[model samples]
Target: MRFGPETWSYASLERVSGQLAGALRSRGVQNGHRIGLFMTNCPAWLAWFFAISRVGGVAVPMNPAYTGTEISSILEVSDLRVLICEDRLASRLDSPPKQPPSVDVLMTSRTLQVNGPAEMIEHAASPDPTAPAVIFFSSGSTGMPKGIVHSGRNLVRIVQTVSMTWPLRSADGLFVAMPLAFVYSSIVECLTAIRVGATVELQERFDPDATVARLAAGKITSMMGVPSMYRMLLATREQPGESGKLRFCATAGETLEPALSHQFGERFSCPLLDFYGLTEAPHIIAHSNPAEILERPLSCGRVLTGVEARVVDDHGQSLPSGETGELVVRAPWMFDGYFRDPTATKAVLKEGWFWTGDLARQDAEEYVYIVERKKELIKRSGFNVFPAEVERVIREVPGIAEVAVVGVADTFLGERVKAWIVPRPGVAVNVEQVLAACRAKLASYKVPDAVEELQELPKGPTGKIARKELRH
Candidate 1:
């Protein structure tokens, strides 16, 4: 039982993917070639992804939200020879980017349609498991997007290990509301479904009510989302019966609030699992299992199988358990490196360990609790306050629906905490009331100095709050 733009079972995926592989082969797409995908979440994206990997072409999935300039930078840097994009998205292209390093483009149907067998999609191509299979981009330290490359073997290991860590079966129908362009959702929801032969329902965009309807209709048995999605869904009784068929729910991309997690468990009667990962090393380096979740409420979970995690200080010395430091992860599914960026890659990938920019502390039981992204720390008057820490506290306010805490320039203090909040519909929330709520839970220095009400909080491509963009 498989579903997407078209009803494709596990067996059908193989047949269509093989045919698509042949189609690309006929179009001269070959081993180690870079093929760009510029469409949103759809069956075509998944099919072409597997098809590219099957024939050893590195699939470079581009963000549709990117501007012509941003898209040109990626195509130029990646030197992509061919791009398969939606017909509608093609209209957004700028002069086909005529530069030194150029790329060609292919247009998929503007709307969802069953792909016909293009005879060229029949040639068998040898696959190199160790060669690059996918290229995902992340904002570089140089203020540009850098392509991160992963191999076929790496993806296979992720599927195998995540399955071992969390038991997912073919009987499960996973509904993923997040964009597949993000490696987190791409692998966990899309690739995992393909690996386990499970059914998948893809939504182009995420709407709280629409997602609930899908869940209530029982079209999906499993779901994965960021914390913001959870908060929105819980605000209203959108889909009353949605939780009945759900076996489990996984939350990632931000810190999971314990209060909200508890509410989710009580309301749905399903355990809310917490997963931790990054774009560079894109799988569950640590995941809280269903049983462990109740005991370790704030923990991301024990280190995943085939993965090892440690906390180390600035000098690279291992920190004692319960002490916070940079997280170092060693996992089987980690990426090779950022494509063509050796310096940036070397900074994170050192001696078989991926130095995650995230800060965390471990307990005696080896459970990991993420403090915050290292860059998100606010140095205010010589005191360090984590924005996530403050945001979590303020979100408990009754009328606050979504909240993002960012550090803004201050005169006396190096930076001041600014809270951008989205109030619940038809509810009036005063800034003073929100500050009072935070004061009860936070230190004096952590209290937000200013509060701004937003119609909606800005989100990055991966669904996390785009605080950097907001700060500007």
Candidate 2:
């Protein structure tokens, strides 16, 4: 793993993780211990992660940006035995019943800092593939994220699934600016690349300027990011030089707007393939390659080799091609249900299939097109409104950087359509102009009843627009 001027080799990874594992064992970390990893993206994050799982522990990777409230909630439900984070972020965990962790906090720098013998794992065998390996939380774009559990087997299945999408070679370098806390970054991005012995470029956080400059330097063959990151990357005037070896950029955290996808293609001269997955599924249940994304444009590509997907009605009957319904998926890498939340787990999972609360449709060729979250649909004057349909149209309007359509409460109608938009840095957006744009392409009830422009929109840990935040 390379971060800026410093690069950590596979030997360094083994050594550092060994030393960290020794520290874990000394701190009473045993098999199946649930440990919280609260930090941003870094090479050492992998060190501690490998260390936790090396000692037969369950790694709980937490977003450093999570509020004290969210942290408190995780502490209450995750049954976390230990929380390891940088010393700088220890302050944020000071909440709820005077701290919920039984084990002491372990703090380290963003770089490898463990000091101990490397023999801890020198002769040890590979970790169990089916043993609990990780507990990942939802992105909470709509509400509080849920804790989803997975084993090493689940992680490997998705890695194998994504590997078939990217034509990665061992000599190739993959750039990862997304945070390690997100499941996409861990399995789809890093593990998939590492499976072929590819090198990784890590970033502590996504900085548009830094990433653009890194791409211009030309060692990267591929990269992974979300739609929001792509928007900010395009907004920067720093176009990558011709030395660019970038083959294609993959995104999965959020829906990729068609306009944003085209802008990325025109700017970088590479395909911006959008993949789709859920925390419950770990990563990459369905994906697109360069040819498919260009040909189909709006489709989320075909389901992976070992996954099964269906759009079903409210009564749980599967819908036929081109029909809109809730998407339910079953994957070889499906999560081990939500941690300690049987009620919530039962609500989504039924008879081995995970009920994804997404309103989507399928093409005759079996491609998926997610329209909106089941809860995000707006009902105005007896009409159904999918937010993605409205947002896609609004996003195509000139001078709009990003847009999020939400359903707000109404007295007469059950709900009213509302839109929150962010214009280009220097452009000024007014309600009348936005309404005019929506009016041209939408039905009277489909148009936003209200429009408000902001400097920026609130985002969840995964960089998706936080519609719940926009509702208020």
Candidate 3:
């Protein structure tokens, strides 16, 4: 694995992971204990993740950009016993009022580097296949993020299935620029490469210039990114050398526009394959077959082996081909459930099928086309941002009377958060103040890109905010 200026072999990585697991055990970490990982993409991130799993503890991967409030909410729900965070990210957890005191903080620089006795300590046995292994928090419609738990067996099955589908050779090198906290990177980039014994080129964060330089140097064979990352890379002047080592470029986390796909393919001389899946399922249900990208440019491609996908209506009845409806999927590697949220879990999962809020249509040829999101979720630059979450944050501002958050189309970010506010009588509210409040309490992406003052918010007959009207 390569991260920035350092590279490590598989043997070295395993040794580090084993030592870290031993260190964690020395600090009272026990099997089935919940551990949080809040750090940027780097070697230590994977080392800590593997260490937690090595000792049979549940790993909770959280976005490093989360603010104190966001992190506190996750801690409240996840019941994390220990949080291994990067030195820089640990400062965000210092806010006294909202800081989680119950959770112990272990700096990655210090904790992960601590060496145990040379005598190797035997790690805990692997948990059952059905045992919860990791919890990935995804934005929920109700403003709080939901922790989706995936079993050890589920993760293994996903990696095995994906390896079979797109068999990566041992010599192949996979580039991972996206954050590992997200399921897309965790499963597709990190675990999949490990399962196939392929090298992984890691980046602390996505930088178009650095990534393009690596591609030009022929350092990576395949890369995975979101739509925004691809766009940035295409905008760069750097071009891949004629070596033709970089073969595949896979995109997920957002709808891949056809124009962007075409431009990327033409510029990089590589197939820009798009995949469709969610944190709940944690694997690509539909993907563009490398060989058939030219034939089916718009389709996300057919479902993979052992995965069932159907377009169903509001009543859960399957729709005919070419009819748009909610996409429901049943897969062997689906998540166990939302951690500590059985009510929310039951709402989406039923009868062994996950009701993906995404709307899609499948053609007669079994190719899937993502239409739109039926849920009130906003995807800004591939990060799920719930409208309610932004609305709730905006409402906390003193000058706001009522607020509504909606996503506006953007050429670069796919969608940008836009807030409309209703000011109280005789009280002046400015965009700067509202944005300042958001920046203090929310992540950078969750902050509204634009704010507009409204005389009064439009409401439906039921006296609720008319979000659809605001979109128009």
RMSD for each model, in Å, please?
A: 10.9, 10.9, 1.9
Q: What is the RMSD of candidate 1?
A: 10.9
| Lowest summed lDDT window (length 10), candidate 3 | 110-119
Report the error of model 3 at residue 151, Å. 0.6
User: Which digits, one per residue and each the tens of the lDDT, describe model 1 over residues 305-409?
Assistant: 778889999877899999999999998888899999899889998899989888999999888998867877665543446776677668888988999888886
What would you estimate as the lDDT of candidate 1?
0.75
Model 2 agreement with the true structure over 149-253: per-residue lDDT tens digits: 898888878888778767777887898876688787877788887788889988887788877787787767788776666777777876539234678687764
Least well predicted 10-residue stretch by lDDT in candidate 2: 137-146
Better by TM-score, candidate 3 or 2: 3
lDDT at position 435, candidate 3: 92
**Who wins the lDDT comparison?**
3
> Could you estimate the TM-score for every candidate?
0.78, 0.78, 0.95
Candidate 1 has what TM-score? 0.78
Q: After superposition, how far is residue 155 of candidate 1 from its true place, in Å?
A: 0.5
